[model samples]
Structures are given as C-alpha cells and as structure tokens.
Target: MTEDTLNSASIGAGALLSVLREGPARTRTELVELTGLARTTVSQRLDALLRHRWVVAADASTSSGGRPAATFAFNRAARLVLAADLGATHHRVAITDLGTTVLAERTADVPIDRGPESTLAWLAQTFTELLAESGYDLADVCGAGIGLPGPVEYLTGRPVNPPLMPGWDRFPVPEWLGERLGVPVLVDNDVNIMALGEHWGGHWGGHWAGYPEADQLIFVKIGTGIGCGIISDGRLHRGAQGAAGDIGHIRVAAADDEVVCHCGNTGCLEAFAGGAALAARITASGVLAKDSRDVVRLLGVGDPEVVHLVRQAGREIGDVLASIVNFFNPGAIVIGGDIAEAGEHLLAGVREVIYKRSLPLATRHLRIQASKLGDRAGVVGAAVMVIEHVLAPQAVDTTVTV
Candidate 1:
C-alpha cells in the first residue's frame, strides 16, 4: 500500500509499539507499568499489533512466583528495507530486516556521473538479485533508504545543484525509486548517513556500544570530495536548508597555493586537502597515481612524500575543524573515507592541530579518531534511516491497520 493510502491507528497504539521495539519483551502488565496506560488500553493496543503481525506472542515470563504472564516481542522479520550508498566512483546495496540486521549486501564500481537513470536502473536490478539470493520477495520490503554523495533537499529527496553530479540537479530520486520498488523511499546526504551509522553502533566490526554521554559528534569525510555530518544533542543537525555540515566549501587560511575547487571557488578546504587534491599532487610528482586509493597504497608502504602530503592534508582539515570545535564544542570527531586509510599519520595530524588551536574547554574532553566502519558506514547508515523511519510512531500507525 502507498504511504498516503495506509490506515492509521491511535497515538496510544503507536506509543505502545515503540516501547516494545526498544525494550525487552514485556507482558501486558509490564507494558502498562512502563507506558502508564490502563490495562484495557494495553490489551487493546496489543491486540491491534498482533493483528498486523507487528508483534508476536513470546514465552511467558518466569519471574513471578505464581502463574507466568504471556509476553510479546516486536516482530522484526515481518518487513524488510533496502539500503543503498552511492559514492562518486563506487556504490553498495544491502537488504535488512526491520531491526537493521543485514541479510545480503553487494558492492560494485559504478560511477555516479553516469546519471540517475542508468545508475538507478542498475541498482534496481541488483536489488532484485540480492533479494532472490537471500530468499526474500519484493513484497517483503516495506521501504528503502538511499544516500547520495551530494547536497540533497531531504524533504524532497532531490539533489540540489550538486557540483560533482551532472544531469542530476533536482532529480526526483524518491519518486523514481519508490515507483520501481513499490515502497516508500527516503534519501539523504552520504556523510549524514555515515555519521548516523557510526553513532548507531555500526562501526568497529559492527559492535561499538556507542558513547552515551557524548551527545555531540562530527563525522568528516575526506575522499574525492570533503564533507561532514553533524550530530547535536543526539540528533542529526541538518540546518535550515539541509546543508549544515558543508565544511569542504569553507575557506581555510592555511592554504598557501591557490587551488580552484569544482564549485568554482579558490582556497576552499576541499581544494587544499581533499582526495582529488592529494591525487593531483602525487601525479604531478612523477607518480602514476590514479585516485586517492593509490595514494593510500603509497602511504601504506611508508612512502615519505605521500605520507607527508596526507599528514599535511590532515593538518589543513584539522585547521578548519578547530574553529568548528570552538563554535560547536563537539565531544568526538570521526575521520572517514579513502584518505583516512592513512591511519595514524592522518589522525595524529588532526589531533595535533585541533588540540593545539582549540581552547582548553573545547579540547579537554574531545576524542579524535578514525572511522572504524570505513566504506560500510554509508550503507549501514542508510539502513538505519529506513529502520528508524519505518518504525517511527507515525509511520507505524500509517503502515499497520487493525
């Protein structure tokens, strides 16, 4: 059913479902105690969820000394979501359950410059293949989330005059994909999803417990282009026009040589420190490096010049970030993308600059580190977006009917 056509339930039912989804399996009595709902209201909502198959009966709780009470659990397998992370030169797709458990995934070297029609067609075909391989049908998918390597008007799910994406300005991505997939679609900036992925415990072998105390975070991506994802007070901050963390376009005072950025700006941070800049510098030095990956390979082998350039780029990025730290006072800064593969050299440079420039109050509790999820961050974040949206109280009410 279409999102607009689905029936909705009372807010009380939605609230009850949310509690079951987040907490341990609970009986009717426990739900009443947690939600402050009357016993009859809890029973009514539970019956509605059971009718929609959004929740299922579980084994009785054995804690009470008398008769065991029947419990209910959120039915994670009742629906699925498709997630895609579209990069400048590569892309990844995955199928996940409602709980964000990935069942299948695939990566390919598809370029975004190929435009939306060609790239999205390939994505649809690949998704079909992935679902078949994983023994799931198209009807099982309730929604999809896509992350693009450009500025997006999140409300419309359309790219807004993206510099690197030609012929994609104002493309109706959600309508196009939703029509083909027969599910609602959500879209956002790639780095935004990466930040969400990192925060949702999708990093470090997919097992980070997350920092409960540090509610502010900055995720910087230093690849073919540069961007950042900002989280403030435990929520993604998209700003007034969904361009909150566009740090790459910010001018840096440390840039000595004039470099023209693709956005037709000179002395931009991306021009001085992004992957393309590093690749150009390396190729100009008689090295046949094709992209940032080659530069990372050189750095891995301890190439002194490559290492030096990467570290210098880190310092430049950190220079821009120090001002951000002073203004935002984020507790953590996570570096991601191909350039971050340089590891300690990059982190050391960033730490040095941030620690040296920022005030003591800002830097005192700051934690700077490399992204543990690497390239997987975007896809995982996309999955998380779909999961959160699909399970939200309003969305759940719309999707399920009693």
Candidate 2:
C-alpha cells in the first residue's frame, strides 16, 4: 500500500528512528508519546527497525512498580561512512560510523592536478584497504562524502571550472565514486566541509566545549589559497552556484594593480595574502621556499622575513574578514589550514585588523582563533556530510519499513 493510505496512528519507522537518534534510549510508551503513534504501530515499526539493526535494545527503563519496560537506541555502529578530503597537494581518507566517528584513516601527498581518473582510482583502492583494515567491507558503508579543493556544484556534485583541478571540471564525482564503492556519495568544496568539521566538531581553538552560539560561525582556511566556509543559522550556506564563501577574490584596501591574482583579478585579497603569495615573496627574496609548508618551516626556524610575510598575510586576510564580521556578525571566525601552524604570529595579525576595523558591537563577542581540528578538519567534515545525509529522516524512511 502507498504511504498516503496509512492512518495517522501508523507512524513511519523513520519518524521513530529520528527521535531515538537524539540520544537517551526510550521505551515503547515514550516512543508512542513522542511520535503520537499508536502503541501497536510504534511496536511494529520498532520491530522492523530492530530487524534491520538500525535500533537495538538498551537498558530497560526504571519503574516504581512491576517489571521495567525495554528501551531502544539508535544503532550508530550499524553502518559506516567513507570520507575523503582531496587537496591540491594532499589527500586524506577516513572510514567513519553513522555517528561520524572515525574508525580508520589514511593520508598521503597526492596532487589534484594529476587528473581525476588516476586520483579517484587511488581513492577507490584506498577505501577498500581502509574498510578491510577496519574489519568492515563495502556492504557496511552506508554512504561516502568527498571534499574537493575546488568549486563543486552542490546539486550535481561536479567541479565547475576549478582552476587548481584542471581535469576534474564538471566530472561526475558522486556517480563515479559511488559506483566503485557500491554506495551513495556526496561531494562538496573542501572549505565547505572544513567549515562543517570545525563547526560540527566544535573545536574552538582549544578544549572549549558546549558553545551555544555556534549557530553562526565562519571557517576560514589560509593555505596555498585562501577561502571561507560560512555557517549561517547552524547550516553550511552554499550560495547560488555553490560559491558563497569565495572570499579570496574580494578586493582589499592594501592591494594595488601591481598585485594580480591568478583568477585574472587585480588587487584581490588572495593575491596579497594567500600562502602562495607569501611563498612567492619569500622565494623572491632568495629564500628558495617551494610552497606554503616551506614557508611554515621557515617560520619555525625563526626566519624574520618569512615571519613578517606570514603576519602580513594574516593582516590582509583579517582586513577582508573585518567587513564580513560587520556584515555577517558570525559568532566565531576559525583560522585553519597549513599556515595556522605559524601559531600566534598569524593570529596576532588577523586579530589586530579585525578588532581595529570591525564595528564595536560586531567585535564585542567575536572569537577569532586558530583551528583545534587542524588538518583533520576536512576529513572529519566529509564524514559528517555523509552521516547527516544517509541518516536523515527522509533517507531513513526509504531504508526502513514497518
């Protein structure tokens, strides 16, 4: 029978699963009350969920009189999610449970420009190895999430004219990878997933926890290139064409016509402040640094010129963020990527500009700090993306039946 034919008392298995996913196991009576389903309907749906291993019997509920009622909880371990964070020069793959907890992970220096065929082939093989290593197989993985270091159309999961990723433009990432892994896949820009990782993972510079104001947050990644992931009202806001937080192209006061950006723009923020810019400047000064990682190493060795360059980049980035703070007024601005390794040197410059240029009210409770998740943010966020999608109520409704 069609779902529309069911009576109001015949609640779907997904609705019951959603309530249990909120934590704290509930008994049959509680599930009936919470979902407004008849006791028999709740019991039937709960039985189906139990048969599917989506829900499991937990400790019985305490009672003042008679025997305790059996309770059921969301079975987070019932399935797994494969997550991949592919960068310009590196890639990290992880296997996580339905709860987004990492079960196995692997990392390597795999370049994106190597083309999608080779890169994705390596990813597919690596996922197989990771699943085996974690004592699981393809059947256990519910879905996969990938974060590419370029512009990805959220609806199509295809890279559209990604400058760094030449061969990946408009490639069918989800369908291609999903075929290899035998599960559904989701893809998004790297910065967007990093933002999800930072915000959902709740790493606020240090061990700070229980941040109630996290509904509005921004994650800024200052690596070889600069970009931001916006969290508006507790959701990742991928704007029209999935380019909402492309702050790197924004023009800044410090930039001049002489500062040409790779995107064919003059005096853009990234031209003067991205890690590539600092590396270029340092190399031009006869430092022989190859990339952003080399620039960080120079900072570690107390290279005054490199230190000055990084701090200046931070200031340039902050100058752009100041306008964002005033306009968006996010609860926090999290700094991450390879450059964040420079520690206080980078943060000091960013804080200096944001606090000085932003409005008093905007900067009053603003938190500008380093990322606590560091390099792992991308992979963790990728897993979070898949977990949320596969376990969502609608998807669950299709997977489980009463």
Candidate 3:
C-alpha cells in the first residue's frame, strides 16, 4: 500500500508514534488531535504501546472535577536503535534510545575501503564487541541503521556507481550485513546521515532552533570528496537517479585546466574541493605538510596561505551552492568536512558568494553555518540514512500541496 494508504494497524501505530515522539498523551483529546486517528484506535495502539513498555502511565491529572485520568508518555529507555556510519578511514557506532539519546558509542580506525566483504566483517565484529561491552545484547536492540559514503538506492539497499569506493558498485550492503548481524538494516548516503544528526542533535548553530522546523536543510560535505543531502519538508529528497544532491560530479573551474577526475571528466567539483585537491593545493604551496586536516590545523594558527586555499575552495563551492540555493531555497546550509574545520574562513567565502549571486527573493531567509557535527557529521549522516529507511512511510505516489 502507498504511504497514505497504511492499514489500520499501521495507522494506529503511526498515531502511537506521534504521541510517543511528542512524549505526552495526558488526555484522550490530545491523543485524538495529535494523531488524527479515531479515539478507539489511539486507545488500542496506546494499550499496545503500554504493553510493549514503549509508553508509560505517568503522573495523575488535576482532580478539579472527579478522579483524573493518568497522563502517558513514551518510555525512552524501552528500546534503542544503533546508528553506524561507515567511512573509508574509520567507523563510528552509536547506541541511541528511541528518544535519540545516545547511550554508548564506539569508534574504530578500521579501513572501510578494504572491500565490502572485509569491511562488513569488521563492522559486524565491532557491533558484537560494542554490544558486549555496553551490556546491550542483540535482543534488546530495535534495529541497526548504517550510512555509507556512496550513492544508495534505498529501495534496493545497494550502492550505485559509487565513484570513490571501488568494489562497492551496486553492492548489496544491507542484505549482507543484515544476514550476519541478524537485524533489520537501513542504509543511505553518508551526507544524509549527517543532516539527520544535525537536526536531531541541536547542531544547527542553535540559532535557528525550532524556527523553520527540521525541513529544508542542506548538508554539504567537502572532504576526500564532495556530496550533499537535501532534507526538504522533513524528508530526504533522493530524486530520480538518486543523484539529486550529487553536486560533487558537477563541473567546476580548476586551477589546472588539464586536471582529470575519476569520473572521466575535467574540473569536476570533487577534483576542485575534494580532500585530494585540498591537499594538492597545500602540497603545491610548498609551505605546508600537504594534509587537509593539517591545513585545518595550520589554518587555526592563522597561516595566510592555507587560509587562502581553504577560502578559495569555499568560494568555488559557494559558486556551485549558489545555483542550488537559487533552485532549492533551503532554510539553512551546513558546511561539513575537513575544510569546514577552518570554520568562518570557509563559511565566509561561501556566504559571500551565495548572497552575492543568488536572487534576493530566493535567499530571503537563507542562513549559512559551519557544520556543528564536523567530521562526525558524515558518519552520523551515514547512520541516519539507514534509520530513515523503514522508519519512514512508504511513497504516497500522490501530489501533496503546500
């Protein structure tokens, strides 16, 4: 069935989820209004939730008239979803309760580029080790969400022509990992996971908190490569070809006109701003150690040359972001990656151009901010891609009018 045509139980579950998410159903009236479900259905689902310990009967209501009915809220400690972000150099695994409160997290420097077979084995082993260490057994876990640094067809749970990570093209990641881990798996692009982490974890600069809702967020990654995640209207916009935000492949001007990219294209965005380019610029500068993170470290020391390169990269990125802001008009832009570690040096360049080039009407309320999640953003974004998979409603296949 379509997302809009969920069965009665799913609807009831949806209603219960709404209440659980909001954390209060003190009265049946509130439950009815919040879920749009029939009162009886809400009651039944809530009963099931209560039985499952997902909800609990809390304090009593005021005794103004007669005996007050007790209020209920979600039991956050009842269930947990593990979020795993798989990266080329390292992996981050976190255990989060239903409320998104992380209980225990583990990090490993296991190389993810060692092919999917070996990497999945390491990942499964890490999960097992983490569970054992945290006293959180497999039975207590609700599900596992994983994020990868590649384009993923969520419906098929496979990478599609992932440019950087070889031997992972159209790889059956979720299926393979699920069979070994014995948990329902959800997977998506790494950038998508970071966007969710920023939204859920209070990382959107804390200035725009609760203003525009978590709907229309743009998280841009500028690291070993560039990628992006677009969360519009509170949903990930994968678009046709699953390349909606694959701006890394977009052609851009490079210092060397002859610079070739892995995608067999000249002067693509990644060739300009990816981790390699950042290092190449620094290495060619003859004044730095030729590392992006070191450039970030040196930028912190006010090195003019490194700062200039990072800002230049930011401006180039902003040149591209300008086209996107003109088209999408996202509420906020989160700069994430090693270059983003330079903070305002990079963000100022982006904001300068985005505001200068984009139409005034389109950028009316646009706010650009450095990613509060930083390097962790990708890994976290990766995990979120997976969590959003089955947690979300199926495609409605019907037009929705704002």
Candidate 4:
C-alpha cells in the first residue's frame, strides 16, 4: 500500500491497537471506554487486529464479574525489532519483541573507525545470528534502531561531521541498515538514546517519578568522549540541527589546561575530562594505563594518581555542567560512561562542583547520580526508539494497511 492510502485509512484500528498494546483491555466495553470509540467501531478494529494476530484473546474467566467478557492483549510475539548501540570502542546488538523485551543480545569490541560499510555489514550478520538464536526469522522484524557515538541528523539518520567517528560523516546509516535488514531504520546520537533508555527504565524516580515530572533531566556520558542528552517536557530535546547535547565540544574556563581535543579545539570539556583525556594523562604520568578501562582498573586498585585524576575530571565536567544546570534547571542529572564505573570518586567531584556553583534554586531540587542502567542503556534506548515509533498512532495505521 502507498503512504497516501495508509494515511487515508480509518484511524479506529490504530487507536484500538495503541490502547491494547499499552496494557490489556478486557472486554469490548473496556476498549470502548478507553478509546472512546463506538461499540461498532471497536468491534471492527478488534476484528482487523485479531485477523492479523496482532492481538490475542485472554481467558474469559480472567475478567471480573458479569458475563465474563473476553480480554485482549497485544501479541508481542508477532513481530520483532533490531536494536544496536554502536559506540566508539564497543557495540551491542539485540533482538527484542514489539513490547521491547529483549530476547537475545550480544556485546563486542567493534570500533566505529572501521567505517559505516564494514561496521554495518558486521551488524547485519550479527542481527541475523541473533534472530536465529532467538528462534525468530528475519521476516518478523518490524524495524531497526541504531545509536551512534556522534551527532546525527535524526530525520536522515546520518552522522554530521562527527569528530571521533572518522569516515562516518554524512553516512547513510538508516538507508544502509534498512536495505540490509529489509525494515525501517531509525538512528540517533548514542547519548540521546542512553537518556531515553534511562528514562524509560524508571531511573528518574525518587526526586521525581515518571514523565513530565521527571522530564527535565540530563544524561551526561563521560566515556571516550563527553556528551549529554537533554530531556525537556517529557521528550528528548534534539536541537534544530540535532546537536542540542553536544556538550563535549563546549570550551571550558580552566586557565591552566591547554589539552587539545580530537575535534581540533583547545581546552574543550572533553579534552580535559573525557575517558581519552584521563587515559592520556595517566600514561603521561608514567602509569601503564592503555585506555579508560585501564584507568578504571587502576582506580579499583587504589592508585592515588588515577583516583585524583578522575576526581579532578569529575570536577571539570561538573564545572561545565553547573552552567547547564543554571540554564536548563533540570531536576536530575545521570552520569554514565567508562569512568563512571569508578564509583564515588567521580560522583563526588561532580556533585561538589554542581552544588557549589549553581544557583540555590536550581541546586535545591537537582538530583545528580550515576546511571542505573549503565552499559545497557544504549541498547535498551535503541529498542525504545523502535518500539515507540512502530507503536505510534500513524505508524500503526500504516502497518495495519500494509
């Protein structure tokens, strides 16, 4: 079916499907109450969904009281989504059901510098293997979502002049992956998806709970690079050019530091506090750390130098973030990435600076801490991206017609 035909179809089915997918809708009466649809329209939409096995009937006895009305739930097994989290030094791929339940997942040390063609080819093969292991066929895939470690034009799913991702600038990621998987592909910056993952995983509770209340949040990833993801008014805030959270490139006011950034800038926040910077600092200090992971390992062994450097880096990051806090006034800030694994050292420095520098009003309600989902945030967020898009009202309408 053409896009025009799909859009022109009756929207009743989409509405019903969306409601049912969120949770079980017991009885036609309940669906009517929830969707505000007439009984006849509800019946028509239910029939269409049932015919396609997109929904299934639960035991009638499960319903409370009256004449045991039939209950229906979204058929999560009917389709799958492929989610990939591609970082600078590592990647993860997973196969998830329509409901975002991961069935199979694999992690590897694939570098993005291998370029899009090679990296995507590896992902394609890995996705096929993941599906096979999960006992699902490639035909069952409804869509795919990937998170790249750089700025991306969300609409086009293309990296835009990414500093660390050599040869990936303007790469047609969605087109390349979609053609290989034979499904719609969505892509976004890695940190953005990580924020989505953390938000969806209920990491924004306590200080505030759920959307809207927890909407004003910031996710800072201090890995090989430093970047942030902003959530405002219960939605991811990608700037007009999809660079809203490119905090790594922001110049810091540290007068004594003149470290050069990979983006060819001096004294940027990432140059002073990112994983690469820490690793380089450790190496230059006559330590044998190879990368950020090594620095973390040294920190684990109580190396005072590594500990001091990490804490200082945290302060540097927090110094930059203090301005962000004053500006955005986010309720929560989640810190993630390789260095975050060092635990309190990083958090202490960040908290110390943010609380001391930001205005009292902003700092009073702010809750800053380590990431809850940790390394899995990206993959889970990628899955969320696919699940959300595929289950949207318009997307469901198009799918039903197709």
Best by lDDT: 2
Per residue, candidate 2 scores C-alpha lDDT tens digits across 284-340 of 998988778998999999999988988988889889999999999988999988888
Candidates 3 and 4, the one with greater TM-score = 4
Ranking by lDDT: 2, 1, 4, 3
All candidates: CA RMSD (Å): 4.3, 3.6, 5.0, 4.1
**lDDT for each residue of candidate 1 in 1-402, tens digit (9 for 90 to 100):** 222322334336666787777667998888766666678878888898998888999988875678888999999987888999898887889998777677899999888999999999999999899999989889999888999989999999999989889989999999998889898899999999999887775332343446543468899998889999998877889988899899999998955545788998888998888888899998888886888888899888888888888899889899999999999999889999888888999888888899999999998878898887788788778988888887788767775664
What is the lDDT of every predicted structure here?
A: 0.85, 0.86, 0.72, 0.84
On residues 203-308, what C-alpha lDDT tens digit does candidate 3 reach at each position? 3246557667447888897767788888888677888866678898888844465978777778788888776777887888786555456778888888888888
Query: How much is 323 displaced in model 4, in angstroms?
Result: 0.9
User: Sorted on TM-score, highest at the top, how do the candidates line up?
Assistant: 2, 1, 4, 3
- TM accuracy, model 4: 0.93
**Candidate 4 per-residue lDDT over residues 287-402, each given as its tens digit:** 98877788899999999999999999989989999999999999889998888898899999999999999999998768888998888888888988988888777767776752
Residue 116's C-alpha lDDT in candidate 1? 93
List candidate 1 stretches off by more than 4 Å. 1-11, 202-210
Residue 290 lDDT, candidate 3, scale 0-100: 51
Model 2 regions more than 4 Å off:
1-11, 203-210
